[model samples]
Target: MQIPTKFYKIIAIFSLFFLGILIFLGVVFKIIVEKRKLPRLYIEEKNRALRGSIISAEGYQVAYSNKLYKVAVNTRCIDPQKKELFVRLFSIYSKIPPHEVRQKLRQKRGYVVLSYTIDTKTAYQLKILSRKLNALDIFIPYKVGQRVIKQGLTILESGETRNFPYGDTLTPAIGYVSKYEDSGYTKIKGIKGLEKYYESKISPKQDGVIRGKRDIGNNIILNKEAFIKKRLDGYNLHLNVNMLLQKNIENILDTQKADLEAKEIIAAVMESNSGKILAIASSNRYDPKNIQKRDLPSLNPKFTEYPFEPGSVMKPMTFSLLLEHGLVSPLEVVRGYNGRMKLGRKYITDEHKFDWLSAENVIVHSSNIGIAQLAQRLSYLQFSQGLKMLGFGKPTGVDLPYEKGGKLLPPYKLKSEIYKATVGYGYGMTVTFMQLLSAYNLFNNDGYKVTPRIAAFITLENGKRIFLKKSKKRKILSSKTVATMHNILQKVVEKGTGTVAKIDGLEIGGKTGTAHISRGGRYQNAYITSFFGFANDAKHRYTIGVTVFEPKTKHFASQTAAPIFRNIVIELINEGYLIPKNEQ
Candidate 1:
């Protein structure tokens, strides 16, 4: 009656062998199970938070984040019989070609990403497509394992992606964030302009974590809402950037850049009394979204970075020095050296033939020869020190990165009289257009020098705002000198070289410069033409600086930059940025 011993032994051996295999698999897969669960566990512990918005003074969103959805398909869930139908219908929902969807559906192994960053409308339609096809299938987004068992289509809630509303319009000054690939992780950092300068204030770390059950897919489940840390939103930056003014300036510059076929144009507008930079625009700027084409070094707020010879623009600073030191008077007469004079080995000449002109007439006529005569009265020490005091050879401490400290020759190095003389008429030195803007503020701000600023305040999520403090003012010139210079500059706009800048009913004053670009220590045929002035109505005055680099058709500041300045001022008046003095 006993069973065969060989058969009994064989059955026992098979059972033991099968049991051993299970044990080995358990040991091996224990680590794999834990490793596979790490992503899900991490999501369960983490929260989701948002980034802050970068806004303009006028309350326009410059850089902000918006929610986007990813539409995907679980190929494994699709029946082979309905593959073509699924692809065709899903393609309609995703706006993708059916052929492409068909290929993914045919794989039938895992999930396929059908689309990314789809709008809510398309997402809703996708959900509808799932419902219509499966009849009982409801596209419940973010379920356990990124799947709705009844539906093959997976609708997922994705993280926010950034949106630049203005694109390149305010990019140069507002700047952008960059992704740094460091040590196998992507780190976001601001790499230029305000974005770079105020990174700490704008970009707070994302401490948000998803603390809920997620399906095998990393999507958070509908079972529990993510408890997120709102601290990551950081603080919103309200810049002194006037979006409309910025748009207008950019439009004008773009048109002029094309017409002139110039290399580039740099322009900015500032609140004269407060040193607030309202709008800065450029012909060349980087699109923040296009990371590949951006040349970081070339893209900048040019108004504060690029330096050029002041040309006649320096004449005002020099004349201010002469008046401040009591070395010159309004009616002080000086020979223009018959429109020419010898300085060291160079013959400094005026733009026109002049016999004699008063100190006031010198500025009124923009007489280089007259300025040279004034420079002769001062030693090199006096001239160099004067420029230093006027914010030359220094950065204006502007709220930007890579601000330039312009070239100012040492007094000891200025042994050559021509160096001193050329400096008097805006040569032998280089200053940024912004430094000029800061220096010229002295005349309008009653001889007080103010630092130019871009950011106005930081608004927190709690509804409290912290306004940025204005830079401390330093009196670089006496009030009497400021008034005298103002009167002289007004005359210049009224009846002199800057006459083109004069608004008919408004009082405006400024200087014109056509500086020769130096290459290899010699003056090139090219010139940096510019006009910077302050135009005032009854209530407000704005300082505007416009420069054209290497113009093809015109070479004079009066012709190129002056007209642009005039148009800008007239537009300001027309737009009621300036109220007429009579109206006031």
Candidate 2:
């Protein structure tokens, strides 16, 4: 055993050979990796893409874009054995879903975004996490600075994110946006409301290059050629809505939401002649900032979406139809069976007892039996045509999203006379609050039909502005018929259930509606209290519609919606919109 010098020499030679090979391989690998991850010098880039803005007619920015960042990592460079630890630590700072991090770690190569939302503060913490673990593999696409590099984390200036300055105020109407990445390209998608409807006009994909030049320190150079972007910025939508009126509407609702015990309340104000929406509001609102945090039900938009039985508000249309077609005169009397009448299988009831009432009394008293009796005289064609003339059974053609036309059955589908009778009293049919508003505006606009609109105009960066033209004009009723209808509605406020809506020395015409909301297969006790009206001054006229749903404190529109309507008019007038003749 002591004479084993040959064996010892052989073992030493083998060990030396293996050690030299190991050092050579290590040097080669380090050189390749270092070259591959070498820092670059002086970069030029462009970001010509700018998300468009939504502005009001008064030139206030409602929705605009703000820059945001996305943080990501090259999975191949991260420690493989410590993938779980990496995921846990990454999620702590990134706020990304843990399961999502795990799935990305499985890739073990290429790139996976830790978060599409790395802000300035968060970007700093990400740097700390990366430094503590030394796991970040920086790959700056364009700009880089000390601000850019923290620990080993990569900060990608991932273009812009949308912001609503007024929060949920115009959300359902203005809509919202979401982000997605496909084929190495990032995009913003308009997901709802006006955002989606005007997507092509507003936040369309970029049309030009976003160019910029930077020095070694990532300092942006201010050179014309170095930073040039042929910016075809999206057009700025100027809404017809008046911010003053909109604010007043919302403020009043907020103060009354709890007192009314309302599950929801929807109201709209439209120009009597042009149908331009001045203000539209809802009680149950959603915030675009924290939209994802709330339940989906909270996001249900009521302005142009919620459709319900329109109730006695339809009485005016019934009276207008009878007047327009010369089917009946204002003073013509109809038997009401003393405020109660059975027609076929159903019965119509009135709040007041009336054996016989004038056709005008039918509307003034909001008598269901009276209107139903008058409706029995008309042919199905006349009955259906009357509703159509007032924009019922049709979508109001509003630019907002998810607008429902509400159901309108043809004459043939009328299962019984009761169904037709119910339609007269605003049952067996459904309509959106906007549609109801537009229909009533016919009386205020001197019988010339007006189509409801939300957008007023669009302004572009080049100072070119295009105003939205009025829809094709159509006269649905004669001037005389409108006058007659207006007189009847005036009587409703003066001597009827809607008396609470009356303001001193102001001529107003309104109708109250209280209908049981249909749920599951049958009507429920849940009610939609509504008041549709026009507030008239010498020079100013506004048509308003207020609807409150499932109120706990009150079940009547006169109690819940009318007084709110009165208060709104008072505020708007006090704000100097309406001026009475006596005051003038």
Candidate 3:
């Protein structure tokens, strides 16, 4: 191995350099691995102390998370005499049976959770018990649970839970939640009303970890060392509904339903110019908070679900269409004698017979013959197209769930004269209340059809507010047609069937409708009561509609529904939402 001194020195230096490079690379790799693992450890540590506060709109804490002690015992650590006394005292204070306490004490496990989330009073009592019994293994560990509704009893005597304060008032609008017996988790269900429709947005997220049960006689220790993910609360909803107006409207409906002894009542107040629903009240509504069982029919309503012949209300649409197409003028006279007209094989009759009635008089009197004759003048295609344009035979695209799109007979498949005549009077078809309201928007908004919405704005937990803008208005009718329809509706209240709804000081314009329910393809004598009105003040605008189904006594729209409209309008006037024209 005899090598030169310079070569040997060079080899030694190269070897040292290679060794140092290896050491430096190893150190760098170790640091990279440690950095990668650091985030997970940090996450676990932070989650162990995770806490959040739930604030209301007024910035008060509705719920929050705080640290507290969970008390437990290892029965094996104490003498039998001391254990028996400790178990007896604990049973009385903690409400666990002494026998179960004795059994838990006999277990070989080192830790057991006797009670979780104990208050200061109970903690003090447990401390006293621990001293008196001389038991050193009365364990108390830090834990967290939600502290909600700060000043209420955890469990009430009536077995009814302490829920949102305005439960009954918001039942139909805000839904309820219930537990699944099989899953053992709270599920947001649309037991009824708006809750069901917006359940996805309102429901709280579920924890993916499954709950496990401990063996009998073993101490149950929740791994305080184990990691748990925190849950995010459901989004808060801000509705266009004015709660004050909603309460008053509910009260009014309750009072009226009692006075009239009506079977069912529904009233909806909407912003005339914007189509924002201010309040919707239905009498005989079930309490969402207390519903142990679901009654499908009574929970929603016939107004939203059941579609019936709208009767004379369809008259306005017909008249509007006629005017829009330049087919008729308000003053044009038509022969409607004896209140009857024969169209093909079907005979259409008005409630009262009159001769030489003008189109204005026809709408004022709600002449069925006049409307039917006017419809006959238009080709079947034109009539159907007009209806479709006005949003009939389609859904109104309202934000609420389970809205029904009214049914209309196919124009291509019309096989009978009776079917056509029946449709002329709002028969042989069906329409939801929302659809009708949307259709009426054409008459109110100068033929600009606006989509209806319930949510006015959404507020985030960080105090950010986002307002929902209305969609662009669709033009469905000419201004001239709208003007003519407005004149006809004005006459409807001035000297017509809707006169009962006339406000004393304000200019009120609307229509009245009474439709008979059909059973087994025959028109039943049972009638539905309805009244729709739009009022404009110098600054404020309002549209109100009321519908009552199967009233006990008189069933006419003018007698039953119109008075309710008048009451609401009177209140609106009194509240200054509608000022008297003379004041302006």
lDDT of each: 0.78, 0.78, 0.66
- The best candidate by TM-score is 1
After TM-score superposition, the amount by which residue 144's alpha carbon in candidate 3 deviates from its true location, in angstroms, is 28
In model 2, the number of clashes is: 9
Give residue 375's lDDT in candidate 2 (0 to 100): 76
Q: Listing every candidate in turn, what is its Cα RMSD in Å to the true structure after a full C-alpha superposition? A: 5.3, 8.8, 12.9
For model 1, how does the per-residue alpha-carbon lDDT over 1-584 read when each residue is reduced to its tens digit? 88899999999999999999999999899867764533434355433344577889889989875545677776656666666677777787778888877776566556777766676678889877866877633232234674334345667656456678778888687777765443333346677888788878877556555465566645566554645443367678888988888888888888888888888887888888888888888888767877555456557667777888878888899999988888888897888888778765778777767788888989888888788778777777777888899988988899999899989988876556677678888888899989988888888889988889888899887879998878888888999999999888889888888888877668799888888989999998998988877888777878888889999898888888888888788768766788766656
- Relative to the true structure, candidate 2 has a C-alpha RMSD (angstroms) of 8.8
Candidates 2 and 3, the one with greater TM-score = 2
lDDT winner: 1
Query: TM-score per candidate, in order?
Result: 0.83, 0.77, 0.72
Question: Which window of 10 residues has the lowest lDDT sum in candidate 3?
Answer: 151-160
The 10 consecutive residues of candidate 2 with the worst lDDT sum are 138-147
Q: Write the per-residue lDDT of candidate 3 for residues 264-318, one digit (tens) a residue.
A: 7888877867778877777766555466465345666555676767888888887
Ranking by lDDT: 1, 2, 3
How does model 3 fare in lDDT?
A: 0.66
